[model samples]
Target chain A: MSAGSPPGVVLDPWLSGVARLVEEGFDQLDLLTAVDLPRDGVIEIVIHLVRIEDHAHVFGHVRLPRADPVLESVTSILPAAAWHEREIHEMFGVEISGHPDLRPLLLQSTSGPPPLRKDTPLVARVETPWPGAVEETTGRRSRRAVTPPGVPPEWLGEGS
Target chain B: MTQRCYAVADRPEVRVHIRDLGLACCAVEFASAIARGLLIPAPEEPGTAAVLVISGTVTDALVPEVVRAWEALPEPKAAVSFGACSNSGGPYWDSYCVTKGVDTVIPVSTYVPGCPPRPEALIDALVSLVVPV
Candidate 1:
């Protein structure tokens, strides 16, 4: 953990430095996750690793610019990173260089924009009639009718 | 012996609970019937047939417990992972407390795909596995 940061340590020189660390120290790459910081126009990628004895569990983070977020793939260094990096790429559109295969692991090919992107708007869920149920349109806003429980009203539709 | 079964809609019941709890720490109530005897045996049977229902905070330590429980079960059993927390490890997947998915610990067969799948869906899954085609 870095002195200034909350609980995470920020790696300098970003992807390259982290790749070197993975190569030299940790042989096993456990997992990879990303945090979208749209406010800063950057995405933070966290890489976790553990040694054989599980004594040394370390994490490294790299921040990529949102404009063209790209980083070196650690799949070569650690094979487990393949799916993790693919998920990150699909969700955030982060480019991973030298990746043996870079494809959308989760999202469908025909799906619209990335759902997890910070700027992408969330869709509202509409409850239609089962088979032949009538569509009820009252004086109330269509947004409210389709709004599912627990889902934010704002994300449902435009404010009426 | 007699068996009792309950059914609930996947839409309103399951999704509502999942939303209430959030995927991070959602808890799905397992029908006591299934939990009483479901077991995960060894990996020798090619495809380990056992459903590992998971929810709440899944940790690395929890993996061993699940594996041990599964290993103790009889052969030719399948796993039905109910709830988002169990299937994809839910909101806590990326977090430090949760594993990405329960599959990391034990093999999974069917993923119910909800924070908590409706009782009806759970029943359907159970029936599909038990009832022959």
Candidate 2:
């Protein structure tokens, strides 16, 4: 893992390479994440896969043009990656082909374009402060916090 | 004999705690107590323990670093995802670079929820670790 170099093996004919990885049974899909490189006009999709025996990881990268970034979904082969892929798509606007359900995993209908997109400005919102908490100097309010895909927010709180 | 108490070194204890929590590494402040050995290694006894307190943005990019740090310590430890980032990824959750929670990369035994948990809360989590499930 060199500095700034992407993780995992670089396979030519990217889509087929991922299909081969799937066939090899290194199919435990750990995570699907993306990086937005606005300057380059592309979004880099990173797929993390693990070997069941020792949890050895292999990453697969696909560079998609920002204008029409799309890739085949691995959900049919690895169900666990479904939500993760959906998250990447919702956040980065990278379309996943062959996905059974391609709906917004996060973001309210009024929230405008994909917030994680490189071009999106970091806007602040204004909201009431909690009791006894000091008011923030910045007028912008923070985004509402949401529970992670698998865990509940209450589970991370006191009672749970 | 009079008893004396010293602050434990934050880095070493954090390393040990991560292992117990089933994490591989962490990004910590490296408090002087950890460097000075005030925080003794847990005895060889069956249920020895410690705590790993986290705050701010904890994402996938930081996972490998945390894992590497945890690998350098001995086992039978426990972790306390002591703040927002450790428990829920805090303000960074929606961002592409942040992870959902430390639990995504490492196993967490207890979550001490707060933007930054009180030191007393951290101590309580450590006590619980030694007391058994």
RMSD of 1: 13.2
Residue range B1-133, candidate 1, lDDT tens digits: 1112222232212110111111233343454323442211122323333333444455655667666666665565556666777776575444433566777777776677765566455656655555565
lDDT score for residue A117 of model 1: 73
Which CAPRI level is candidate 1? incorrect
Q: Compared with the true structure, what per-residue lDDT tens digits does model 2 show for residues B52-118?
A: 4444466565678656554443455445576676687666544545667877776777887655554
TM-scores of chain A across the candidates, in order, are: 0.69, 0.68
Quote the chain B TM-score of every prediction. Answer: 0.60, 0.60
Give all candidates' CA lDDT scores. 0.57, 0.59
Question: Recovered native contacts in candidate 1, as a fraction?
Answer: 0.00
Off by over 4 Å in 1: A1-8, A125-160, B1-31, B34-133
Q: What DockQ does every candidate get?
A: 0.04, 0.03
